[model samples]
Target: MEWTLWFSYILLSFVVITLVHSLLLPNLSKIRRIEGVPLVSVLVPMRNEVRNVKGMVDSVKKQTYKHIEVFFLDDESTDGTSSALELAVRGDARFKVLQGKPKPEKWIGKVFACHQLSEAAKGDYLLFLDADVRIQPEAVERALGLMQQKNISLLSGFSRFILPTWLNKLLVPLQHFFVLFHLPILLANWTKWPPATAAHGGFMFFERSAYQAIGGHAVVKENIVEDVAISKRMKAEGYRMWIANITSVASCRMYETNAEVWQGFTKNIFNGIGRSIPLAVGIILFYGVVYVGSGILALAALLVEERVLLLPYLLIILQAGIVYLNTREPLALAFLLPVASVAFILLLVSAMRKSVKGQQVEWKGRYYG
Candidate 1:
């Protein structure tokens, strides 16, 4: 019992400390302002982004940088998105809406659209952004400056979450925990080991040279979680990559409702964890036992007045609280970790089932599966 308690405490301590370090510690890369403001092409691949396209287009128009051209790709969206983009791009010489080429049977929707956009892009730097994300006026300038200063090839980071409901707060914010706890950013740029690769496709900037060298989006045309795969490939191929907390520069509402959240997470959860059944099962069980078992043990300790066992359980709760607080997820959701664990397993099972049946994942209105 003592050995078990000590091991659990050690694991909890390690996890909490790592997360805190990643969030609190800053990476001090020398950021330089874009020298002479290099021409940048902002490419947005859209499918049924009617609710988001106009605003994203307008946001680019408001950029502080002058030599910017925006290319919007309508990936066969049937939700009146093309009409919205047409109206938005009308008479705007800097913005052009391109009809997406037919998706090759082998290519994923985003990668195919992105590949087409890259072929048409005329900028020295290519910024791939999702239609759902809104960028501030200075974002382009800041990214260019950071890229120049850090001497890095890719600038990938997350944006602020614009959650409007409790459900969004619960599920959407859990992604912070997902990224932070699993892939700590503090150790991502260390020189000793391969950097922990991560990128939010909602906002990513890459040099045209690097993009072309890495084979562009065409390389990972079939990956469901395309961004992470791309980042990993880039890192493995020796392109410098860095991620910052870009919460101040941009914002995104990943999903509007609970159903949207479920669909969104279900599509990528398995892929994010590497599609390993044994690993996924182990994670689900690990969290279930520690988080769920701790709660039950705490309750039993309360009823039986077992102070010795209660101390460790209390420490576990403290660890969970710190994790929740740092992740910005609702603390109440901590108690439902077991439920979330089960849901994640079910999502992975669904994803694997589809993959085995020669089907892939789907998002928005398109069936990439």
Candidate 2:
């Protein structure tokens, strides 16, 4: 029993060490700007985004670069999203609003929309963004600059969210923490290792040449988590892909309520890691035990005066504390990581149950497993 505890402590300590190193020596590559304006096409896929469609369309209309073309694909949205887009783009000559064709049997909705957008794109570079994202005035210009300076084929940025409610504050911050601590973008870029990446899918910039070389959406047509898959495929095919914290430049409200967050996450959470149940369950179980269990042991050690175990307990506490701090969550919610970890496990279990029955999860008022 003692050995098991010690072994767990050591394993978790390694993860902590990696995270700590990530914090102290975060190697963020500098963002560079292109010398002149580059012809860019921005593609947005929309479905039932009535509340947000107009604002997103307006945001693009306000871009600093005038050489950009905008394509807004309406994916059979029934909630008057099409009309809203029509009104938003009516006076703008650069903006073209097209209706998305029906999703084919083997293709995911987003991928199919993107594939169609690519066919209609008439620029040297393609920017794929979700309908909900609102970019700052210079977002596209800055992204193009960074792409040119870094010589990267793909550029992905993380966006900030409007936490209008307490539920948003509690859950959304944890997602950011996982992105920072568990999958630090700096480590992937600095070490010449394959970048384990996260993107706001809300905002992505891709070179047309790289998109073609890697086979574009056609390669990942069936994947629900096509963004990440596309990034990985791009890297594997020897194209440069860069990810950075672009939270300052753009923001979105992914969900407004707790139920919305659950449904939104469920749409792709299971398939994000893989559709395999055992793989998802094993990961949830392992992390829950290591992160949550270690904290439990540390608390008991303090209460029961287990002096011999004090060092390991302290190590666990320190590791978790550092991760919490880096996460930038409100101190109270951040400290409740054990609780959050448990919640994640429950969500994974829920996903597994649904996937087992071949059930499709709903998103944007449409169902996809």
Candidate 3:
């Protein structure tokens, strides 16, 4: 019983430290306007993203950064994505929809598409955005302002999830929780430490010279979690990387249904952590005790009339609240943290089971191990 109380205190301490670190996490500079900015190449790689093409093109047309060329690399998308893009960007010279070449052996589909975009792009800076992402008009201006000020070579962050379903709300925001709680801000942003890296392909901004120096996406062609892999490569080449609070400027509706959410996470979670069984076990135990156990203990505390058992549960709620506040997610989601944590644990278990089975994970109509 006393140990439970101590563990709650430890969780409280972690929450405090995470809150302090969250404050130091970079916010996109409020640079509303800029003159004579360098040519920026905005690249979007699509795979059966027909529903998103018009929206993506519309967002690009509405951007404040007019000196930009946008490329829609169609990765053999069969859902009429290429035709949709062409129709959306009709008479717009700045936007070009390129037919992506066949993905070679040992290369991931998205990475191959990005490599083609890199080869074709001619700009001082490169911005890779997923098709489902919607950025504010001033997003590029603010992002470039921050990168220029910090002299960062690569900048990326998970976009805020546009939650349209209960499952989406519960799972998507956990990405923010992991980023704030697991990643150390100073080492990831200030130093060129390869292991201390985190990135999101949803909104990756790169300086042209630094991107070329690291061989672009070719360096991490086979990596399923290409975002983090590329970021690590950037750091390995002595280039500084920055993870920003991009929720203010960007939002993504990544998965449509609960099944997709489960599958999407299962596909990347194991690979994201380097496919280490020990790490998976450790994560399971930690979540089991620290998160899921909290709710269980709280229930037991009510029956046994032991009030202290609720401490960890309440602390976790506080932790989720703080994380949501910093990440600009709906604060009301805080009340559902325990439920979400449980769902996340189950998702992790599902992910681990697949990884152990050596099964090929299917995503966007392609299979990957």
Candidate 4:
């Protein structure tokens, strides 16, 4: 086949993959409620999250699943996070505020906090909620329903991201794109292969027995990307893992500012790919040719009035449309995918440079390699 045909084949493959992948991710809205009334411990690890304290408290407070005990561990925050957490859940006896122990050597801050929360938890199901997340009242119930329906031990869902800025929309939604486009959803959910796992730290719900069986956060104690690390470990131990589509019932605004976005992504993006330089380069090149190239080709096609030359760009837009359909963004935003592609490529490159130099990445005022 000629180069154009080869390029067309690859792009078409991605479109098909995206279609199949999206279908494989379980939709929270579509699942029927489960019959089990297992107790769930809503474990939240907080560090300088004063702004999200009230929102987090209110969401879990209103959960229709009445058998939940919420645990909030303050990870030694200087910004009065402990006080705020105390005040937010003051009237609610179901919520417990625990002061986090000093993080021992070789443990990530959040991981240590989560470990403490699990030690104090007395529930059958452990739902690790991030302080920034706000879920619907039925979110917990539906999550358990999916777990029972799928017969999975660990259920992790990527929430609908609230993009407050143009840059936020451009970059954050790439998470959905990468997940739906690259990961074989069937393998990740059904297979016990460690390498096939993907997870979001913001919302991780695990069966307490399975979590303990897999060694929990201690298994991934030193891992920089603990969410993915923990999921992989669960798979390694022959446990089932499911990545769900909880966009219908939950939303999270991860980074409030562009700097936070840059830093947070920089800290995780390279490590998220196992710190492989080749994978980073291949991803940058792939987007450069498939997505960014589509824009350039479209412009040239318009100049020459060639209808055939527009096919690749149109296909790219169609692929974007399918992804945005699940993300709840406007269908028209698909046209801006090339721009998002560029932004992602640049961010990846910046992360790569920092990783290559052995620079420590910072999060919540703590530095890590």
Q: After superposing candidate 4 on the true structure, give the runs of residues whose Cα lies further than 4 Å from its correct spot.
A: 1-6, 31-33
TM-score of every candidate relative to the true structure = 0.85, 0.83, 0.97, 0.96
- lDDT tens digits, residues 1-369, model 1? 686578566756756774675565233233445676588999999988899977898889898877989999999998999999999889889999999888888888888999999999999899999888988888888888877876778778777677776556655655655555666565565431344777888887998898889898989999888887888777877888777666666778788887787678777777777777787778767666765566566677788877555554555545555556653445766655544555555666777677557775567666654
lDDT, candidate 3, 1-369, per-residue tens = 889878988999979877977898988748844445699999999999999988888888888878899999999999999999889989999989999999999999999999999989999999999999999888888998888877889999988888888899998998999889888898888888888888899999999999999899999999999999999999998888999899888989998898888888888888888988898889878887788888888898999999999888889888888889888899888777778888987887787788788787788899978
Tens-place lDDT digits, model 4, residues 2-51:
66567777788889989989888888886476776789999999999999
Task: Please report the TM-score between candidate 2 and the true structure.
Answer: 0.83
lDDT per prediction? 0.74, 0.74, 0.89, 0.88
Which candidate tops TM-score? 3
The candidate 3 region of ten consecutive residues with least summed lDDT is: 28-37
lDDT, candidate 4, residue 13?
Answer: 85
State the displacement of the C-alpha of residue 179, model 1, in Å, after optimal TM-score superposition: 2.3
Scanning candidate 1 in windows of ten residues, the lowest lDDT window is 24-33
Runs off by more than 4 Å, candidate 1:
1-8, 23-32, 164-167, 184-187, 191-195, 298-339, 349-362
The clash numbers for all candidates, in the given order, read 1, 2, 0, 0
- Between candidates 2 and 3, the one scoring higher on lDDT is 3
Rate residue 57 of model 3 by lDDT: 84
lDDT of 2 by residue, 1-369 (tens): 587567656856565764754454322233455777678999999888899887898788888767899998989999998899889889778999898898988998889999999999998899998887888777887778877877878888656666666556655656556665567556444333455666557777899999999898999998888888888888878878776666656777778788887787777778887888778968788767765775676677789877544454445445555544543334555455566666677777888789888998888766888
Model 2 error, position 9 (Å): 7.3
